[model samples]
Target chain A: MAEHEKITMAQAFNQALRDAMTADESVLMFGEDVGALGGVFRVTDGLTAEFGGARCFDTPLAESGIMGFAVGLAMNGMRPVVEMQFDAFAYPAFEQIVSHVAKMRNRTRGALSMPITIRIPYAGGIGGVEHHCDSSEAYYAHTPGLTVVAPATVADAYTLMREAIASPDPVVVLEPKKLYWSKDEVDLDEVQPGIGRAVVRREGTDATLIAYGTSVPIALEAADAAAAEGRSLQVVDVRSIVPFDDETVCAAVRSTGRAVVVAEAPGFASVSSEIVARVTERCFHHLAAPVRRVTGFDIPYPPPKLEHLHLPSVDRVLDAVDTLQWDDV
Target chain B: MPSHDFLPSEQPVQLLDQDGRRVEDPKRAFPSDEDLLRAHEALVVGRRINEQAYALVRQGRLAVYPSSYGQEACEVAAALVLDDQDWLFPTYRDVVSIIGRGVDPVETLTLLKGDWHCGYDPTEHRVAPQTTPLATQLIHAVGVAHAATLRGEDTVVMAMCGDGATSEGDFHEALNFAAVFKAPVVFFVQNNEYAISVPLARQTVAPSLAHKAVGYGMPGERVDGNDVAALLSVLGDAVHAARSGAGPSLVEAHTYRMQAHTNADDATRYRQDDEVAAWQGRDPLLRSKAYLTGRELLTDERTAEIAAKAEAVATVMRDGLMQDVEPVPGDLFEHVHATPTPQLREQAAFLADELSREKVS
Candidate 1:
């Protein structure tokens, strides 16, 4: 509890994993660079030194093998936490995720449950290559039997990680790559039950800006800027994608009369689009304008130089709020 | 000359003589009349279940039913060899094999019913779900075998797939993995002549599916799939080898598909009726019936009784189809995650509200 001093998101992640591994013998971790190099992102640093190779180790370079072996381990009463070096590298393992892990429990009529957590540092803004900076939470959300969650703050990251590790089903915790180095004060003394609820990062009366993962900070920044311009912008950081917090989102949108969903995933069939459609349906009578989405373009993740354009920035979110027809208000 | 190598080219075991006489192979353990009748009843049940499933598909009651019409003996033989504690990994067409292991017929139909993604649980009755993605379950079976061996449990994992699955990379990898690990799993390859529309020749260049096991350093045997006795004897030996910690063995059951791959698949485009007609002459059921009739164990009256009972069960299944469980609108979001994420919960609630409004209107 005394380690509550300011720490980077990576350090928080390392601590969360260490705490989980020490608390439960069933919690094992593995990935490619996880052993000797302590992960490419160093999110799993010092885990190997503390837990030894058996509890924390490196798998073959094959992502499918890592996931498949994890499925086997889970079936045999072991909770395995797998790390994908980057968001894009997790694609090869998608086969196991979709065909095996997600469906194993339901396929076996609830006889087998995959208590596997896949830690992926996702979304651009980290200056990574095309494959490394992918925001593919949409792919996992679309998959049945897999819980998709993205933590925006250091506290949420630390809390949600322990929850994900203890979950009886397969969970994908998408850690915001840009937030890895973002430092914040976190308390890891107590456990939390935030299974599927969005937190109100900022309360306001104007348009509600909905976002998750890396885009959460941009939405908060946009809200702050909106307040200076005399617009009371409410911001909601949607932590979970599968079982979304409709109550928080709808309540916020009902009061604001305007909603703008944001995400780093491509706009086409993106999680943001789903959010926009839901807001339009539930908050239509209170709407000052059609629900909008401030998200990445329909194209693939752009190069590092152009990622700023692809990702929804504070200015883009502000523009969405400003352009909304609020004359009725 | 029989040095126990038992190459596919060597003399294959036979029980029924060419003249339709009952002849017991001295080298094999003969099954009792009770066992043979049980096998016969299994074939009848398998045939009836396939017929009912196909009928349901035609009536718009099911999405697709891959009929296990022609491969009942292979399933029954393999299933009968397994003890209660042994595991069986079945492919899409193993409805009969699972049923032979005492799996409820209704539960087996869930795959066709499209109620579950994986369709069956392996832990219950020591049988895995019906694997639909070709030979993927073969590797899973190997892993299960490895797990059993690690626990020092004397159990055989019988993984069954079609001839076409032999060409899959997973099948080869599984075979190689099992051989290297010395996993106690029997690889049952039902070489039912064609894989979907692809003939065995196109599926594999290897002389025989069983012979492919030689490359992996495992024993292989080719058997007359129509001859249930031969299949039972071969699988029984393989199962024993696995249970005794003798490593893996591959059994290739040589048979033919009497029906189309599925109600959706048209065999006319790929195969000729002559091929079908030729295989029809070698109907496994007829040979078994001939053996039974010659020995005075069965009669036309008993056969009629079996058919009547099967018809009654089919009627019951058809009558039970009145319950149309239209999926609940928000249920799709239920199992995706143990707890739907905050975002999905919002969508589910939104949908619920939308439906409520529609109901009020």
Candidate 2:
């Protein structure tokens, strides 16, 4: 086993890019400010100096062009890890992402596979401006051929990014921008679980709290609060969103017979709603009450001053858990 | 240097006039007899493909067909200007170009027939799928060429689009990226007058589509798209320039859309018959045939052989398209990823059970 080092999620992401580029000659990194400026968040800091300009370079500041060319590079057998500077900034490239990047493999009938990884720093809580803090996972998850994953922990951040880069199909890694500074001791060389599998961060019996990305930590914090109040809660981190881990999630829901999905995105037609529906259908007979969801309101992302009220917090999650009908059965 | 150095000529480059007379150029040399004959044969075959695809659309075999009827010169030239290892990124209207690259005629119509997005292996033919969305494929070409350049490979990419696509933001970005990175790519815009009813004037107010390239710091050229000889000469030069790593070049082929945008569209609703008739007089195949015969290179026997080869291709396309392709219900769950997810597996099994139940009923 390798020595474990305490590091931030941002550092872990940088290490993952360095390790992947070191291991494979085809892996490339490029985006608007990803090269010289090392990205706005500095998640890609020092990559250009290490990999040289040929492998890590900046583009012409066009989002659609960045994604469109990444598709081309992937077609030519290069593993391109592109960065969308912010969540809302990715809208310009949505057509390319939805039309080409997501459907290229299926469109080619397996003849061509896009081994492209798009890293988006998403979700609110860091008091950034409006566009900087959007939870846009539902858009990517709704697309069939794409693999959407969000890592909340430092360890999963490193391992999941490496996994996304190595996958044959395109993967959208929604890095929690608010959690970029969150740190933990992680084994850099340790192999974690692959994509499409959820991890149970904390196990309990009273109810299950399902969350991912920015919501995972909030759910865990709510679980801790619930434990002090004489109610045990299980936290299921839905690491993968597209090829959703129904086995682990449903098993957790069935065991607890209650679930409350938490997310920072609006609840209307969102991933949280999907999780609630899936839990209802699979754990209907075992449930003590209907599944509930605590999410951001159905409105545009609020300004930083009002973001705390807009984002799902520990109190919001526990309040939803309180509605899971603890006294019904 | 002044912008005029990058601007296209007052008139499009024409090697052979519409009357089949050779136009002398001090800076450019005409193609050889062999290349002319080859291009003429491809023009004939490409015209037959358009005609056959029209018939297929009428027969309800193909869902829709976007005929490259008047643009055969540009299509054929775009395909012939590439090496076997070079990549060709084509649009939906460039089936003739795909055929010129030797893709199976039947496989080329797979997307139109609604059987699959692309039937042939892209790697096998070095052709990207015939992109339906406008101007998106151009950036892909830049990416491929950039990759090749990075790896020290001598691969050039030819990206095809129409006059209207030049107005897209992607077009601007693609040209800028290709020039900035010095990626070996040729932006081939077949200025075929309209994009499904929208004319060039509505699309852009530029002096000419090719002149727009100068803003991106790359040389741009315009050619008489209906003159096969000129198309071959100009596109050939652009491809060679890209292959030699002189960076990207934009070539705008001035032509007309002789037919409606597709079989579903009504050309009469937008343009007058006189306009379409005027372009017919400058038909690519007619001009190519006259030039070839004038050069003593196209004899009756060779013409008949070429026509027969075209008929064989049409026959193959008809036979292949007429066959009913059964959709495999289970295939819906395949290829979404390298490995099927547990949810997909459960859904596949549920679908299978439903199908078996329907059969038992």
Candidate 3:
């Protein structure tokens, strides 16, 4: 047994990379500036020096090439974990990912598999503009051959990454940039609750508030704010978007008889819409009112000064929760 | 460390001239009678299978087939140069190469038959499935080659694409990595002049596709794609260079697409019959047969025996493909991930219930 270690979300992620590399010799990590500079956010600091360049190296600044390279390596039995540096910056690479990475294993009828995990820091509130701050998880979630997961808590950052790397399907783990500095106690060696399921952050009965990645904290705070007003709220962090925990989400929505789905992406076509659809379909009879959504506007991610209106703020989440209508049909 | 041995000539190479005569070059390496005969037979069988597949597509027995009718020399020579330790990365227009690379006809054709993505086990033959999206698989070849180098395995990888595929960004990326890493791999671009209707003039403005490699700091060579013996020698040299870690080489095999890109495409829309006739005059099979006859391997009796063998293989392929394939009930529920998600499991169970008549669609 190993001793417990207090860590930040970023630190936990760093440890997760180290742990995965240590666990499997075939696990290779590479991306632009990931080696000598330890990643743009310093999440991979000391990995190159520790793991050596063979395991942890930097690639030329070409996302498409990086992903295609990973595709080949995975087919040949190496598990590659590539960092996209930022969320929107990963868009170019997703072309190779969608056309090849996602479909390769299925195309080969399981004779070949891509266990590559693409790690990207996503969402706004870090004050970075444009490509650095936009949330792009929905694109990956919509692709059939991909598994999408995000960690809201420090502990999940470690466990979900292990789970993502261990997954046979190609996975993209969207890490929230704003939550990077958020700290919590985590025992590196302890086996806590595993990943790929929704986690109830704070439980209550009046309504269920669902969110993931950067919105989980906002949902939790909203739950607290609603609790002060005597409106009990259940906060659920929806972790895996593709293989969403429909059972957990539906069960919480059914028990509470009302729901609010939240995300930092546009609501028209997003993880939030899918969650609302599933919760509405499964919890139709138990619902007290229409399921509400607190999401980013359909506009392109704006400058940081106006991001408060675009991001799912605590007030925005509570606003959605407040309009449950609670009237009998 | 810099580019080495790059010599892209203005004219395409032709070891066997137009009149079915050998063009003697004192400096070039040549093959033995056995290698030439093997190349000839591979071309013969590959064309027979290709012709059968074309007929099958027309008869509604096949979904699609990108014919390699006029490019058999490129197909045969590319495979003949590789040992069992090497990997062959090919494109969808490469059924001939697949057969030449030793993949079973039925297994290789299953994907084109609309039955599966790829029915054969790739690891068994070291041949990646035919990539349909242009030069996407080029990097995969380099990646595998790089991995092999890291593991100290002296395995070479041969990646084949068309003239149009060289226009793709993935092609450049593959060349860059192969040269930077000095991976043991060969980029065999069969310049068949057209890509699904777009002509070569529109495909690239470059003088030749082989010249694309010199910019990536690797040797690039051009070969006569229809001349099996010349293609065999050129690809053989490139394969040897790669296997010995001399770095990647690009060989542009100049040829012509004698048929429509696929059953869905009409070659008449973009090409002329006279041009096709001109290329048909230098058909890979005719030239190879002419060369094999000169070597006394294509004797009258042996020609009859080879035709009989090719016919038997075509019959087997037809029978294997014509048989009924039983798809498993839960085929859709399998292998989406190493472990299925809980929701996926629930959906699968729901599907099972529906199939059992307990629930309706």
**Highest-scoring model, TM-score:** 2
Q: Candidate 3 residues B158-201, lDDT tens each?
A: 99999888888888888998888888999999998888888899
Poorly placed runs, candidate 3 (over 4 Å): A1-5, A327-329, B1-4, B350-361
lDDT of 2 at B21: 84
Interface RMSD of each: 3.3, 0.8, 1.2
Whole-model lDDT, model 2: 0.91
| lDDT, candidate 2, B124-190, per-residue tens | 8899999988999999999999889888999999999998888889998899999999999999999
Give the per-residue lDDT digits (tens) of candidate 1, residues A1-329.
36668888888788889999999987889888998799988988889888887788875466765676677557656788999988899887787789988888756656788899999989889887778899998899888788889999888888889888988998899999999999987676655447587888999988899999999999999888888889999999999886677778889999888889888788888898889887888888999898888888888888999888888889999988877887755
Q: Write the residue-wise lDDT of candidate 1 on B1-361 in tens digits.
A: 2424635535555665433456677766666787777777777877787889888999888778888787788988989999987888888888778877877666677677776555446677888878787777776677566656656677788989999888876677678767876888899998888889988888877778888878878888888787777777778888998888789989988888889999899999999989898887677778777777788888888888878877765775576554576657775566555555555676899999999999999
Error of 1 at B88 (Å): 2.4
* Candidate 2 vs 3: which has more TM-score: 2
Model 3, residue B60: displacement in angstroms? 1.6
Can you list the residue pairs that collide in candidate 3? none
Question: lDDT, candidate 3, residue A55?
Answer: 92
Per-residue lDDT tens digits of candidate 3, residues A1-85? Answer: 5556668999999989998899898899999999999998888999999999989998877788889889888878899999998
| Model 1 lDDT on a 0 to 1 scale | 0.81
Could you tell which candidate, 2 or 3, scores higher by lDDT?
Answer: 2
Least lDDT summed over 10 consecutive residues: which range in candidate 2 chain B? B1-10
Cα lDDT of model 2 by residue, A286-307, tens digit: 9998898899999999998898
